[model samples]
Target: MDSIDLEVLKTAAAWLNAGHRCELVTVIKTWGSSPRPPGAMLAIREGGEIVGSVSGGCIEDDLIASVARDGVSQTAPFLLDYGISADQARRFGLPCGGTIQLAIEPLSGASGLPELLARLGRGETVERRIDLKTGAVTLRGASADSTLHVDGDTLATVHGPRWRLFIIGAGQLSRFLAQVASAMDYRVTVCDPREEYRMGWDLPGVELVHCMPDDLVLEAQLDARSAVVALTHDPKLDDLALMEALKSDAFYVGAIGSRANNAKRRERLKLFDVTEAQLARLHGPVGIYIGSKTPAEIAISILAELTAVKNAVPAELLVPHATAAPMSVAGCVIP
Candidate 1:
């Protein structure tokens, strides 16, 4: 699913375009153990219709109740705090006596949300500055070279698909992985020089590149926030790219292969002077061991693992088969 922030902004823009009244709520700060983080957002329309959430449910209920009772009022932007007391924390389902602060403002044509969404559609990160006092919002394009600062009256929040995936192959598994990654809001790109593999490849929001895998990886210059998956199973194609990827900052670098093949690949990389630490970063036999026999199931397993890593969850807790009881199938034992 798309991030709740993007969904909330898009929903607010649509309501405003349709001449409906809506308010945008953003979580500016949280004290401790809050359900939502600092950038959490929610959009509430005139008739108590909601698009996103701030708290688990209690805070949303409060906002909806306010809207229902008072109707849509274009009041000055204001901050609301919840869970400030022990009883309030218990009532709001907060883990501790954590307090969350929300900035509630009315959405209008002048909010610059539509323009921001357009920029996000072009795979660009845009910073939205909202004036807490005057309620005027401005949008600015952001890049690696951009500088960011927040003042007393201006709040900035980034809105876009912040993750990217580069898959080096267009085979059946790659197709399934691309589909799943796209559903997870990862901007996915597939690179394969073989025409045979690219002949029938087709998917929405996925860029297909007929270029050398290593060259494409270098050109992409993947950052620490990106992921690279080598699925071609060809050393000449996958190995070179993986070597470069390992040297870069991509959060996840993986290759698809059988366990034995993965071991052999590691040995070959060692011969190429790759460090033990770099080799350790490689996730061979990529997905969590889930006994996934079909392509779709395997893709799900891989994406689940990637999601866990992206969210910084412990791998042991994320992999279902890792913690579950061991099982056996077809002369193969799974633990």
Candidate 2:
């Protein structure tokens, strides 16, 4: 499963390769309440075929209408604005008269999209810079901190998976979680030293490795944009990984277990010099209490909490199920 932006780029590349004229639209800036954030992309073919989105359906509809009427008139990239007036806001469905600025670049060989996709396939976070006037593009390696930047006439957008999810297990639950996370634009890596658990794991786009969890955690260089989830119930695996993950700058470090097991895990971590502050960052019994009784449901629960943290959603707003309650997953009771 590809992320929405990745899907857009891939579709655009396919259309371009087929000798079709394509135009790529990106949200460069937004004011007030906008439907999409900066760096959101939409790809349109010469015949009005579209993939991905900018401002949900309304703005897309307007773009398609313009394309059908104008017949792809713009030869070079240009900046287009929407919702600048009250009537325009109502027409485009921008909330609170929001104004969005877009950089519409007509795609061709100079766009470097195919090569950009190649780099992304190799798991490299890339910074793509577009010369707005000339419709020329260049690509370079980018760090996780890189963001969309419109400097004068040059537009720089970061592409590829900027976030990482390190899962210390290759079990059934990990498969479901990895699929969902990959679609969410997370570079997911699942590690397990046990051969029995690692066998038959064949999910594409997710890296499955046979290695010790602790060593992998140390080598991961987990930063604020990284998340570590230990789903293997084995203490030999989960505890060691949790210790390393908690010590790193990972925004989220979680472990799946029953309440009793979670308490015991925390106690064990203390003996390894895991600080109270680091231990506090650990999310045990990992996931929002949504009464999940299946592996798929549990995956959703865990991702909900993970997304909240990634977005910096306030704690009170989450209303997380921190309290003890009877929950079961895959017919196994989580007491």
Candidate 3:
């Protein structure tokens, strides 16, 4: 699953290529408790068709109304606002007097959206600058080697598919995790040297590899934005890959095992000269303590933890509701 912004851009490109008149709306600023953040986008097609969102339904209704009345004849970009007043906030269902500012621009040849999509498809980040006054747009290529400039004020940068995941075992759990991760726009790879595990694997959008798990980890050149998860219980398969992963810049490195097994695994890693500092980075009892049981529920817990780390959200903020008790099965608390 691509991000909502990328999806919006792709949808807009499709509509534009089909000769349908459409306008792109981007949220440039927000106040109070707006539903969407800056850079949030929505594409409003002719005849009130829409893709993506800028608010909680009310603002979309307003945009649809505008499209029905004005069509896409306007060339100049327009700044639109909603929920500026208490009454307006209540009318739009924005809690506690929230407000959002949007820049509406008509797409054309000069926008270079199709070219931008092409570059993004190649795993490159690009910056799109829109003139608030004239609706003119400029596209610039960006990478680790490129510098970004926005007048005297450097605008926020947008990225394409940069997140990656390397799964150690190609089991049933790996299949579920791979599908969920792909929907989150991660380029996923499953590595398993055992023929038993590799023979029946049949998931789309995931790369299946028969190379040694540890070698595959090194080949991927795990970076700060990448993640590694070991699903196999075998120490020979999981330990080598995890040892290399802990040495890399991967932000999240985890393994699936019971609490006692996790402790035993850590003890085993001590023999390999791994320091306590590096060992601390491992999330052995992987996932938040959600008390999940089934493989599907366990997958959700793991994804939730990964997303929390990615977004830098505090764990305290994610405490379960007071009314819900922890889930347990067969004397094992699955978290």
Candidate 4:
């Protein structure tokens, strides 16, 4: 599943390649309550066709009409504002007097979109700078922490995978998690030394590795943008991986086990020199406490918690974390 940003990029490239004039619209700023956040993109073709969205449908309709009537006449990038007054908010379908500022640039050879998409295809985070007056563009390497910056006359956006997940087991739950994470644009990897488990795995797009779990976690050079989850439920596999993962810069480290088992795993990690603080970072009872009962539901819960952490939501702002008391069977809470 291609992300909306990727879809916008792809469509713009196609339209430009086909010799059709295209205008790339990016939400640069928002006020009050907007439908989409800044950096959300929409591509408008010379015709009425569009790929992505800016504000529900009303904004897109205006954009398509603007591009079609003007025919990409603006060679340089310009800004457009919608929803300034209460009447305008109702006209553009913005709620609560919302406002959004968009940077609309006519696509050209100088846009550097093809190169930007290529770099993103290589899994490299790229910082794209567009000269709002000249329609010129510059591309540079960006770190995971880089974000979108829109100045008075320039728009710089970050593109690529900003999140990664390393799953320690290649089982049913891992399959669901991998699929969902891929859809969410997370570079996912499932590591296991067991050939039998890997041989039966058939999920596409997710990287599968046949190697020692701990070695993979250590060699992974886990960074703050990464996460590690151990679902093998084996001491030899999960314990070593957690020991390495908890000590790394991974923003989230988790293991699938009961509350008793999670407690036992922490005790084992202490013997391996994992500090109490480091152990505290480990989310033993992984996922928000949703009382999920299936592999897919558990997968959703786990990803929800991971997303909450990614968004830097305070603990008090999030739903209660799930605890592992009684054992779960087939991922369902045993009543």
User: What lDDT tens digits, residue by residue, belong to model 1 across residues 1-335?
Assistant: 44556678888998998999999888888898998877778999999999988989988888899999998768767788889898999888888788988888888888898789888778777888888888888888766434334578887877665688999999998999998787666888999999999997878568999999989889998897789999888999989888889888888988877666678898988887889999988887676767776778778877877777778887657554333345432233443
Better of 3 and 4 by TM-score: 4
lDDT of 4 by residue, 1-335 (tens): 56788889988998888988888889988999899998888888877788888888999987778766767765688888999899999999999999999988888877888899888777678899998888889999988778898787888988877788999999989999998887777888999888888987877667899989999988889998999988888999999999999999999988877676788888999999999999989886788777676889888888988889888999877653434345464543432
lDDT of 2 by residue, 214-265 (tens): 9999999889999999999999999999999999989999988887888999
lDDT on C-alpha atoms for all candidate structures: 0.81, 0.90, 0.78, 0.85
The local distance difference test score of model 3 is 0.78
- lDDT-superior candidate, 1 or 3: 1
- Per residue, candidate 3 scores C-alpha lDDT tens digits across 1-335 of 46677788899899988988898888878899999877778999999999999988998998899889888755777677888899999998888999888878888766678888888776567777766566666777654423323343223335465588899998878888888887676778999999998997887657899999999989989887799999888999999899999989988989877666778888988888777998988886777757667777767777887888788887577642111244452245433
What TM-score would each prediction reach against the true structure?
Answer: 0.87, 0.96, 0.82, 0.87
Top of the candidates by TM-score: 2
Candidates 2 and 4, the one with greater lDDT: 2
Clashes of 1: 0
Backbone clashes for every candidate come to 0, 0, 1, 2
Best by lDDT: 2
Candidate 4: 10-residue stretch with minimal lDDT:
326-335
Pairs with backbone N, CA or C atoms under 3 Å apart (clashes), candidate 3: 1-183
- Sort all candidates by TM-score, best to worst: 2, 1, 4, 3
